[model samples]
Target: MVHQIRPRNSASASMASRKISSMLPSLMRQVIVAFIVGVLAACASRAPAPAPGAPAAQEPAPVRLGPLGGPLAVPGTLSQYRSHWVPVAWEELPGWQDDALHEAWEAWLRNCERPAPAFAPLCPEARRLSIASEEEQRAWMQERLRPYRIESADGNANGLLTSYFEPELQAARVRGDGYEVPLYAPPPGLPARQPWYTREQIETRPEVQAQLAARVIAWVRDPIEALVLHIQGTGRLRVQEADGSTRLVRVAFAGTNNQPYQSVGKWLLERGLVRDATWPGISAWAQANPDRVQEMLWANPRYVFFREEPLDALAADAGPRGAQGVPLTPGRSIAVDRSSIPYGTPVWLASDGPSAHLARLVMAQDTGSAIVGAVRADYFAGSGEAAGELAGRLKQNLRLWALWPRQ
Candidate 1:
């Protein structure tokens, strides 16, 4: 749902500049903490596992643990891209031998649908390996590809991992009976690159309303949920149609109003309305200040519209199509900074945190407005309430390695 088509020239540069400028205040606050975390994480890079029967130590080592609870470390040679690429041994990746790579193979197949130039030649072998044994697949990878640690241009490997999911909500074809918030399709004759009416304008002005009247794809019960759907860029709707029949459909991101996106949670925080800006916190504030719900929502001028598509059996089995123009594999897809990691690349990801400890292979299949920087990524956690909950709570430390075919 967070997939976006980003400009590659001046517009993107301007956006990046604005984003960095706006983040200065918060970045300044975390400088010290980030430094400490960076230092600890650097010491643990590309490490190897300890022997199986090794005796327990008095104090747990600072080594990063693999999925199977093995210590990892190995020195690597540094090269450069938009991010630094430090060549490392296959054994350097945590849990390299233990991952259920068959699960990730599906994502790789999807990547073959529109393979990057560098990856197009390898797609044939990748397809052949789909049904190969894990041992055979791992052997082929070691022989054909090289692993490189993905880090910032300055060589720092630690990064942030957040997540996003396709939300599932109930809707009504005709608005009413508590389903007053409308999820829209793009207004007719809307031009790209030009700013449209703001969120407040769309909500409060009759002229704007008239323009969007026929564009209502469906109406949902909660304004907050509608906003969430908008922010995530897509969602699944259990729609009660005018015919009084219920059917599940997906609302995919169609276009936006071209206004700058403002975080309503940030707005609340700035106004001293709430200390926590997460979804739960925002919901709490809305409940306590019901009279100001519209004001809170309008804090974000940007508006996303969606187009409804039927959720057939095939489509229902897969996640939404990413920016790569391929269906994303639930836990095996991640939105990466294309500037750092190109789309269709196979990546090894490791993260240890409260929400989840993950060590697996995932494809760089998507991108987002906030998923900037060399090391940053947004893990696609799939759809429904469980995925949404995981997505909402997952913000943690991350490390990455790109597996590229050797020339």
Candidate 2:
């Protein structure tokens, strides 16, 4: 009975099951295809198509200010503004709007007196704008000036900044009342092309004294004070006359004796005579060791000659006249390497350190023998004792941007 049941519909059932198995694979394929189409539709809806036109070219990189490490970015379109100079916007100049630009205007007028060839054309406008306010001045500069980042020959913008100032000292017309040291004018015997008596010969030699005797402009009590005048190249003398009257006069740099300049403070520092080799420190060491004063002076062979110049109201108010033949304005004037920054060039300076934070517009109205580099400058602090203190302490990292007229 079991054999007869098994035989019934066995072949037909097997064929039907085989047919269903073949169809099942096709059904699964269709389901997977439908799911993939739905997923693609959802993705297309989520993300909008890009614009029809070609993609825009990438914008240029921002200008580099040089952070703590180095230049953080590239300066685009700046090199195109000037040859061998990089252009910058007013925003690049730190504290640009905050400063009292009137003070700088006064200095700019002084620059107009003997403007650089590039700037000479703008001098007339500069004079007209003298009475303008800070905002107006800034606008005037923006209209006429193009700021150029001062780069070294090797393309470095970083540099060193030092400072100098006028010094005031007590002086006497005659060698009496303990004022024995004499400041002399350029003597006829010392030819311009020849080296003259050094600090040693000028002080001790009778012949040197004879040569300089009639040329004496004024006398000072301390040898250190006399040295300071030589170091400063000019000084304000409070001269007490034989008539017991006192008057203020300026002694300007007539000439140098053609000898090499040396630093007594450096000499002392090399020998470890003082902890700090500033003028005050040198003076303190001198008080402690009076016997070595002559030795300290002889270390500097260079001698500076001066002429007695009467100070007018303008001259009295201004700093010493620089190589540019214009009286320098304190905090607005700088002594740059004439080769790097020509006389009458306007410079936007930036510097910050533990001692001072400096950012301003300054004129390259002055020069110094020591200020010899592509980016070196000696900042003119001011006149008198307070100015001296500031100048002596000023040595910092610097950056410069020359404000030239647009070509």
Candidate 3:
């Protein structure tokens, strides 16, 4: 945003003028200035007068300033599948000055690891500026990038914001001690890009169960937790191995059944079985109707399988790998409509609702089936129960601005 530094206040200017006048005391100097002024006035009067019908001289046009007092830039256009970019001043972005950009620098660094073609050339400078002061970083951005307001093809700028998070659950390497619900890796001989089996079929059909038995990576106590993990696509498991040792591991998304996803809570609501559809509400309903929990789960035909990865100390702190193949930075990574905002693009996100009041820099590092509109985004709230609570309740208004290189 253009932040013009206004001239000094009239009172301050007047005071400074008086102070300078006091410094110039010699009457001879005053006489010399008066003589010079008289000569200039006489010269102007003696100059040839304009002829009749001659054009008068005009004042120069005012200069327009851009962000940080730079020359105003010509707006540029960029096209996408479901959205279009319209150039906007950096000042147009909501809360642009309020955000702590240094907090987002880590995520930007991650984006550099697998940057989009347009951003690759800027990485070295970005890395060098990592430790720079916020003002310096802001100045660098103003000099190098342009902000574009993202809008729908038909010109709508408003969109919905929802959230998702990585689930963390207690589990076991074996199927005993109430840890009966098994999470699987992709089934052997599972056909690619084709419908395999529905959730119900996978659970009920003996042959299908037989094939999946050897694929169970870990077993959790609650079927609902397993379902949550499936819907979330990745999670951390604190597992008790048969050797009586405990270890933390990540189960990242591997593949999903080709069948369409159905929302279990929506199914319950349609059937008049529950009043609220949030995850906590769904869990409450399950607890109240334990006998029908399996039936509720089968409402969603789609299932996601996972591949296990070891989580060392450093890996444990980082989020799951996103579509961009970088570990997401909590509160600074988002899943967007890839067609609208390409992977690795930096975005200015602003949203206000019961769950969060956010105006920050976030990287478009992931995508989801439900995230398919110009302004729509699925915020990654990080891992564990606290993040899950926020994700479950976040459904609000959203606006986005993409930061692109000027060149």
Candidate 4:
């Protein structure tokens, strides 16, 4: 669907003009002030007079979609599935709930500090049990399972922690040992597991230990005010090339704090300018006002302030690899639970001012930090500053369809 252009309110227009003015510095900051003046003078001098009989350009073609897929069954739907949500219960630790821990965790995640080496001792046991030679690990796992007499109807550990715990243990080992974490393909038919690492291993790894120590210190220092929150959102945009080619792009935005912009779709719905809150509806509106696109986004505080890099950077980061380091190519992306959304399903994302009806066939290869709940996804929109901007302004509902499932 396409949106028709309408005159904007004077207030909105004024806000747009102010926003454009403010953006000039950031957008053109690299250029010298004198250069900018000269460029503006040249533009003024070269401004062309409009021809009386000129005709408006034709609108571009609308995005299209293929077949829609059916809904995916939620993971762990089977009786055999076993999963647990382990909350960080550090609050229970006396003097450990202070703000130090929160700060440490953040520093560690940013790779600014290393975890301690105390976690090394636990690595051997973890490796022996889970990541030893394939034969040894398998034998150990079999022996452990023999005691529980736990058997799956499929004879597969479809929902068992044993399937993934070992790998996690190994990962912890590598990280704690100060070795580069090796990315590996999971064995076929195994359920995901939270890789286990010993506390000592966690404390010993420079990065991990730094985080642990920081968190502990923070809690010890300021328990009451140390809480932390994460926020995230995803949206699409219509990008116009200087040569006139147009493309629809999807972006993801993540940040700290409980900001309202974290809910991209909600922010758009509240705007009330678009008739429909869905992706197509908003894309239609954005396309009509190409010149004021950035203004509309900046007007909403929730839609701005992307953590990490900018929009362009983020898109570049989503190279052919999934977040989990899984390889992806055109027509092949990752998907998580179909209940969330099936893997390998094609979706039409409308964003910016153009519609990407068949923009990209995204696979649900990996999960996202905030990608919980049904109908949630983090489209890998590449990486860097451009990607960040695109990600930040992504506030729109989408018409999601599973092209793989005959819907």
Best by TM-score: 1
Best of the two (1, 2) by lDDT: 1
RMSD of 4: 25.2
lDDT of 3 by residue, 156-202 (tens): 77787777777687889987776677888988877879988888888
lDDT of 4 by residue, 261-315 (tens): 2222334557776654444454455456556543443342321111121235445
**Ten-residue region with minimum lDDT total, candidate 2:** 1-10
TM-score of model 1 vs. true structure: 0.82
Worst 10 residues of 1 by lDDT: 8-17
lDDT of 1 by residue, 46-148 (tens): 4567558866523312433233221223212112236766677676688888899899999999999999877888889999999999999889888887787
Count clashing residue pairs per candidate: 7, 0, 2, 82
In candidate 4, how many clashes are counted? 82
Clashing pairs in 2: none
Model 1 CA lDDT for position 5: 18
Check candidate 1 and list the clashing pairs. 46-73, 46-74, 47-72, 47-73, 47-74, 48-72, 48-73
After superposing candidate 2 on the true structure, give the runs of residues whose Cα lies further than 4 Å from its correct spot. 1-84, 272-284
Better of 2 and 4 by TM-score: 2
lDDT of 1 at 106: 91
lDDT of 2 by residue, 232-350 (tens): 67779999988989988988877766777665656787899977654346545655676666676687777777788788765678887888988899899998766566688888888
List all candidate RMSDs to the true structure. Answer: 10.4, 34.0, 24.0, 25.2
Candidate ranking under TM-score, highest first, comes to 1, 3, 2, 4
Q: What TM-score would every model get versus the actual structure?
A: 0.82, 0.77, 0.79, 0.26
Model 1 Cα displacement at 173 (Å)?
Answer: 0.9
